[model samples]
Target chain A: MLTGMTAKEVAKMVKNKEDLFILDVRNQSDYQDWKIEGEKVSSINVPYFDLLDGVEGVLKQLPTDNKLLVVCAKEGSSKFVAEQLVEAGLQDVSYLEGGMKSWSEHLEQVLVYADEQLKVYQYLRMGKGCLSYMVISGEEALVVDPSRFTDVYMEAAKQEGAKITHIVDSHLHADHISGGKTLADQTGAAYYMMKSEGAVFDFMPFEEHDRIRFAHVDLRVLAVKTPGHTPGSVSFFVNDKLLFSGDTIFVGGLGRPDLGGKVQEWAKDLYDTVYEKIAAMADDVIVLPGHYANLDQEVNAAGYVGAELGAIRAGNELMNQQDKQAFVDQVVANAQTETPPNFEEIIAINRGVDVASPERQQELEIGPNRCALHHTH
Target chain B: MTSNKFLDAKGLACPMPIVRTKKAMNEMEANQVLEIHVTDKGFKNDLTAWTKSTGNELVKAEEEGDVLKFWIKKGE
Candidate 1:
């Protein structure tokens, strides 16, 4: 019998510096578009159809020294191929459990907080810097900043024995399509965003200082108006413990304020939010940001992509810059002119003004996320 | 039975089949049936719910091997 390895398991092996020979049986086009990327693992693309006639010819070419990992679109082809390889007298062989589909959609959920009353799971979207949160309080849960893969959140909520009660978007996202509306519609949860965002869709608009309460959960999420990344951006402070800083402040630095075409104005707002509002917050408060530039560096030992506000403030020089004019100048100077890929289309989709096919949305969000500030200083 | 339009959404993932179906239905006349073929396993539930919400009529849905075939009649 061939062993089945999940995408996460394979990722761990690669991280551990294990040599892996990944044989991808997906079609050439898909191989060209996107495939598993790892530091030590090497991959070879051979469409499963090519091996339909017989595996004898292909078997001779595969390396027997390293562990062979077979992968296909979903699992059927990869399993078939792995079985054939095992029958061919290969000593070690395994196939990806759900194949490339699972690999592409793999999400690593790390528990960020756990206490007597509440637990929070941060779903880290590997490769992409997008972060979604599930706050489980008793039998109720609230999802924050959900991506289009609603099933992940739904399943996570189910596993926690909680029903999704509310969905919230920090702002009108331009980097990726917001799943808030779709998820809310599916779960009958009240979807929320800042009323000032001018979203065409129907949602319960929340203002600053509004507390979102879940039934039977001793938790209250306070909406804090940040308004730096976008005019209506707001951060969620959960029970005064963790702050969901959505695109307003990242671990590396603050979110680039120039995405809205008003760099100077937005930069000023960002500076105020950073120096004025965020400065007043307790240093011990954990800051769970919306995006991270480098997962390898940003993710802490706890596996969550965040740190204490004191650490973030101490690490980021921009946070300590008291000169408001100089801060604005530096931010404006460091602002990137190149916009995120398909940002306009993504914004339109988030606003409920337009819709994109799944394939199109995937293509739009295929590249590395450029939502965070890349400037070192 | 004849259909007004045919959409082959096979091998496509979620929201693609629905997005294409919406576009095709927009160009179609009321009461015209749009035939769609898809391979994504989730499309069965997705399409059923989509049609219900949009007021379209799912005349027939049959599975032949791996492909799911659906005929949706446009609503006014």
Candidate 2:
């Protein structure tokens, strides 16, 4: 009988860098757009339609030495293919339980840092390449850039014997839906974002609150006034130790300032934020971001998706620039044409301008992450 | 505007929709039009890829409410 592997298990395999083979049965374009990816992970695609009659044509392509998993848009097709593979005498065949849909929603919690005052947990939404975090102190938790899974944060807080007291969005997120409002309401925690993002909901703006101090933690807020990735992109600087660099600075390069359709103007804001705003920050400060394009490349040995400010500055050209026009020109030229899927709707949802059913939200959030010009970015 | 054959894969999932479409396409005479109704939203992308790969012609595809509709012409 073929076994079913949960998304969490697959994430663990990828995290452990285990040798794994994937037989992806989703359509070519879908697979091209997104799929389970990792350093140790290798894959082949034979759309389930080709295997509808039987798994014979792909039998020769299946790997034998290590674990093999079949994946599809949903569990149905993968299971259908895997059952046949098992029936045909393949020893190690498993299907992703809820398929890519579930993979898209899985959150792998990894503790990035711990000190006497607080412990920071980075929630890697591995399938989506979106990262959120929770800072836990004495019976209090502060969440940053939460995904739609509000319960996960709530549960994590409960397990830590902490109540979520503060929630902050680094900026107006276009790549994925922000759980800022929903999570705040669910936990009765105060939510903070830039008012310039044009959110319909009323909340404490980052502009008003220079620092959000609760329990033993104090987080400094840096709100970019110009049209950044959006008009009001903000980065949270925590105790000068960790920088929650919204979409402004990523591990590889920088955020796509072109999402607002003002490539040059927004790129200039990104340049200023990099030079004027983040210039004084020390090298050792760990830089955590909202989205990651490539996990293996961005994730450190610490098993968290982040990098040191010095490493990012040393590696990316965008981060090292001194001239404003040159930086803007380079960013504009390197702009990515593909935006995240259904971003307009997602922005509306984030701003509380529009609402979506849970099912509709899931549908809108599917496909690959296109937040960066390149994963190289 | 009209199809010679209609397939109701409305409640079906992946592989099933494409499976039935392939079977129906095989049964049809050359150039015959088959209109398919599937509730799976991902079917829109899958149907296009399936037709292109199998040498069938996709005449039209659109979404109506929660269901996805497609018209395909059997390859000669």
Candidate 3:
């Protein structure tokens, strides 16, 4: 029997610099469009159909010395191919469980904070840099900025022995579908967003200084209005120890205020939020953001996407620009020319103005996330 | 199977096959049959579940070699 490995396990091996060869059995177009990427691992694409004629010729091309990682669109083809490889006398072969579908949709849960009163888990959507959080306090939990993979958050909440009580989107997500509504519907949790966003859906509108309390635990989540990325952007501060900065601020840089097409006006809002509101917060508070541009660089030693507010502010020059006009000019100069793919439709879906089939949703979000700036400075 | 429209989604991955099928179905009138050819192994399960939820009728599904073919009738 051929061994089976999960996407997470394979990712860990790749991260550890394992000398393994990835035998991608997916078609040429699919392989070219998207495949696993790692610093050290090498991949060779050989369509599974090509091997059906016979594996004798393909067997010679594969390296017998290194461990071979077989991959396909889904688990079926990879398993069939791996079986053939084993029969051909090659050892140390394993197929990726659920195949490339799982790889693209995998989420890595990193424990960011924990104590007797509260525990925070960050679900990093691997391929996309979207970050969602699960904060468990006693028997209740709150999910922030959930992705379309609602089951991941549900499973995490189940493992923590907590029921999802509330779900909130930091703002209207343009790049990807927000799982908040679906999660709320599934768990009967209260879903919230800012009323100023003009969403045509029903949600508990959160305003500045609104405190959410869990009955049993001593944790209190305070919503702070941090408009910049969007007009209704808000960041949740948990127990004054950790701040869910959302898209208003990222670890690499502040959220680009150009998405709404009113760059100058929104940039001013971003500048004030950065220089006035965020600056007034304690330097020691950990800032957990909504999105990350590069996981390899943004993920810290603890393997979570965040840093102290002081460190974040010190690293990003945009955060320290005291002159309002200069900050706006810099932001305008760096405004993204290319918008997120299907952003209008995504926004419409997020606002409950439109609906999409699951397949349609996946097609709209199938690519590298363009929500964050490169932060070259 | 006979159909009013044919979509060659073979070699396409998940979502693309379904996405293309949905687009094809949109242009077709109600009761019009749309045929799709898919190579992804998981397309069978996806189409079965998708048709059930979307109110479309899966007229016939057949497998030939590595390809899976389905005839779907558009819903009103």
Candidate 4:
């Protein structure tokens, strides 16, 4: 979807260039098999296959100028990188028309990699009728909005041979008592919550763009200032690739906003977050959302857990609405208005004040807290 | 030339007119004068800074009705 050049035009450039920089963003194995063999062609192994986990450091390594030619195995990955570079105000950027596959066929080029390695994990976590995750790197891992059952985290740590060094609450969760504080206490990890939560609930605070270091790994958990589901609601971003969308954004859907009084304001924030912030990233990002709304259906299924960031951009039918005004109108016209009476109780649980006894923690989290958008029938 | 290449940059957002004018100048010959029109209250100061940066000559800059026009020469 880039403008100004076609496949044949780029092919011509690769053939005749005396000095040009060709960058391959594919894994090392693909690079070793076939690549455009002319001038100074280099490959950086940024393996974000199946899931988009780490790419921030890779983006920093790219040159801002001098006719950068980006290539990948298929055009999908490299095209995504080129668009991101353009957004960052880089000039003279273009991706190979058909990625390496086409280049290998047409240019008869050789792909070479010093060492080709890719890490792909299909299922992050699966428990008794629940799917959760402990995203880790090196000696540190983050336990996100965990259920009261604390053993899940410990077991995950035991499996990975890493310590749970950080506990993050996506939002003031109502589905279950947040295990953030408990996990922090046991592991001696810091409990991180959005700064906005200070006004809504008196608790330890963190602000936007705050970088929390865990062991040798630096996990910059961004507090995306999203309000409305509750005024203090926030989402977490790790390395700008994985968006731990609490209740605000779901896979193929959005968070229920009736928890707080400002239904109008909440809808507005959701609009800005979806269209402005989330939409601005590369298409290949992996979106790991907070909740999957499949509990009510008879079939009972896994929530829309993770999705390709590209698929959302090409597919979000509702993102075209121009501004905050149109977004509120659209949400009000099509949102569920029911809220739970026990929402305050749930908020207390999220605040860690209404914490359950060791034996009763498992019973409190029946479903998500009954809030304004979701209710107990 | 009478600086007849008029650019109506009135009401356009910041840096847009400058970016467009830069593009236009890149395609035009040096010494071709460009007449730029802008309505933003800040355009007077914006044009001053831009001309200084690009080393272009601002021949005449003033307000007419709701728009401000700046006649700039492409300095060789």
Candidate 5:
């Protein structure tokens, strides 16, 4: 009996040509942005409500019922879907325990794309890849979405001789712990996110059209509500050039539609936001995603948000055909193979419930490798 | 009422057990006695802070078998 592969196992499988099916359950925009690569990789638009429907079809597509490794932007939904498949008589069904997000963090397997001046880190956690800004406007300065590893951001800031004056979380994340709070507290930098995300956390929140001005950097953090991924998910556009998409959009995939459990409503919202609000921006405006799929067997680290916004435009056929109904249809189809076992723990921690102490945090988080299943932020 | 109300909040995380105790205290009449059970290391400090901040009377607080028990009276 073949169980689900850990991120490490998945990495090995990618190296060796295996007859396994990698099923991606996140929405279309997310799938296009970043996806795990396999000659046999298949994408099913499964929203949470129509999760069973989505899984039934994917099951039909598999050959010989050997082992189907289900995947999603985050691990929670994919794990849920995998368990459901097992219940539905698919004996050899397994999912990436932490999903693709785990693959990015634990295995360090991510797809990266870059231009001469910028680079994007793809596929970090649950389609919520952190974006790092290493700009050399006046000095070698970095901004936004540092990891739990504070030293990385600190070192970058020091090397630039540029103080990190601002740290912004695109939204209150449900996957991966927010290193922003710690970064701000340590560096005396102003931590900012949309007012919606700000309501839940005890921090200084920035609203729409707020501009973060530093000595050499003038970043206009536009708070565009892209709430499919989470209730307070927002997209931040800096200087009308780079967009910091938290979980709202992905490189090859859209965020999980059933997030906040309003798949129908969120699907429509994503449609308007992406086609009208986001697509309306200049074609040159970079589309930085929260995470990307590591379908390419070559890359070992996810692309950064900054790298995404600069290059990944709406020119891709997936982005150009911005049909709201199609996106929703995909979401409705994919939700079945998407439920995970430990989503409640993730949601509780994300909502600031039952997390009053460090021990409580530890208890909720099973491991540091649980980048997608447990809400660290 | 003849019955004394007691609460056990030992070794529990914050915001949950504390919130429950507060709700229980609210339902009790004034001058009623309530006991809380806690085993978390920081419970002593948290409970003490809560008592001070809420103006409740802490009649007794003692450690027994790794559990910290607190006797509190409803504030006037």
Candidate 6:
């Protein structure tokens, strides 16, 4: 009998580095563009059209001993194919529930920090590498850089016996759609963002309020009006304990400044932000970033994607450039020119300048994140 | 712009449009055009890639509100 597996269960298998085999049934180009990836995930692509008649042709390529997963764009085809595999005497055959679309939107929530005063949780978007966060204190919670799944945050807030009172978008995201506005609307939370991001929606600008104090959050701006890749990029310094670095800094490298076509100016501003604004913080402050590239390399033993400010500074040679010119030059030279797939549409929808159906949004966001590039490599 | 045959694949799900198109093309002569209309949004990319890999020519592809139209010329 064939069974269906949720994305969350598959995420656990990937987390444990379990040996698995994935037979992706989407078109060749679709599979080549973006698909599930992990250190232990071994997969192959055979277009769904080829298997409509039967599954006998591809059986030779299947590994009988490995955990077999059939995947497609939606759950329909995978289930259809998995049934055929079962009839062909394959054991332990299963399909991904809701298919790649569900996998794309699946978030693995991991607790990052907790104390008597506050508790923090990080939601890692397993497929897209996008990271969102929530901080609970007293009877209120503050969500930072939420993804499109508003219910996940709202539901999580309820489970913690707290209400979502504040929502912040660290910057105008280019890779994925921001759930800040939707989440705020659903929970009656005060939405915050930079006014210069050109959002048409009502939001509390970070410029007017230097400090957003509620329950226990003394959220202060470390850097606003960045004028880097995105003009309104702001870093949230939470209670002077954790730094929500946004896209400005990553565990592997700095956020590439070439997205806005003014690499020189952006790179210079990034230099100032790094050397002037962020460097003042002590080494022990944990840096929670907006996105990650390699999970194994970026995630710490604590099961979250963050690092100590001191370790990030001491480890990366790019952070030690004393001369502004050399640092700017290096940032410009090392920047990745490839922009995120369908960024224009995603940005327009995020800015509230346009709207799309849920299907359209998922179609637009079906690819890997290209926002962070290593300044070193 | 002109096709010798028409294949209406509207309302079909994954693999159906491509599956029908392949069958229709097999019965066509070399250089004959096969016009297909599909509702699956993903078929846009699939048709483009399918034509390229199968050595067929995609004469034109356009969207009409909810439907995607394609013209594939069978290759020898």
RMSD of each: 11.3, 1.8, 9.0, 24.3, 15.5, 1.9
lDDT of candidate 3 over A35-140, digit per residue (tens): 7766567899876655654578788778888888899877777887888999988888999998876776778888999877888999887666789999998889
Off by over 4 Å in 5: A1-142, A198-200, A222-232, A295-318, A321-329, A335-343, A347-377, B1-76
lDDT by residue (tens digit), candidate 1, A259-291: 678787777777777776788889988888888
Candidate 5 displacement at residue B50 in angstroms:
47
Off by over 4 Å in 3: A14-20, A25-34, A44-65, A75-90, A215-232, A373-377, B1-76
Q: State residue A302's C-alpha deviation in candidate 4, in Å.
A: 12
Between 3 and 5, whose lDDT is larger? 3
Kindly report which residue pairs in candidate 2 clash with one another. A253-A377
Model 5 chain A: worst 10 consecutive residues (lDDT sum): A368-377
Per DockQ, the best of the predicted structures is 2
Q: Candidate 6 residues A264-350, lDDT tens each?
A: 877777778888888888999999998888877888988789999998888878888569998888877887778889999998998
**Residue lDDT tens for model 4, A222-312:** 3445542344346666555566666655555566664555667767777777776777777766666554433222111222246666765
TM-score-wise, the better of 2 and 4 is 2
Q: Name the TM-score of candidate 1.
A: 0.67
Predictions in order: lDDT:
0.77, 0.87, 0.79, 0.55, 0.55, 0.86
Error of 5 at A174 (Å): 1.6
DockQ rank, highest first? 2, 6, 3, 1, 5, 4
Q: Which regions of candidate 6 fall more than 4 Å away from where they truly are?
A: A224-232, A373-377
TM-score per candidate, in order? 0.67, 0.96, 0.74, 0.48, 0.49, 0.95
Per-residue lDDT tens digits of candidate 2, residues A61-101?
A: 98877799999998999999999999999998899999999
The chain B TM-scores of all candidates, as shown, are: 0.96, 0.94, 0.95, 0.85, 0.84, 0.96
Clashes, model 6: 0
lDDT of 5 by residue, A66-148 (tens): 56777764455566677777776777777777655465454232334344443323323322334444333443343455555
Q: What DockQ values do the models have? A: 0.03, 0.80, 0.05, 0.01, 0.02, 0.63
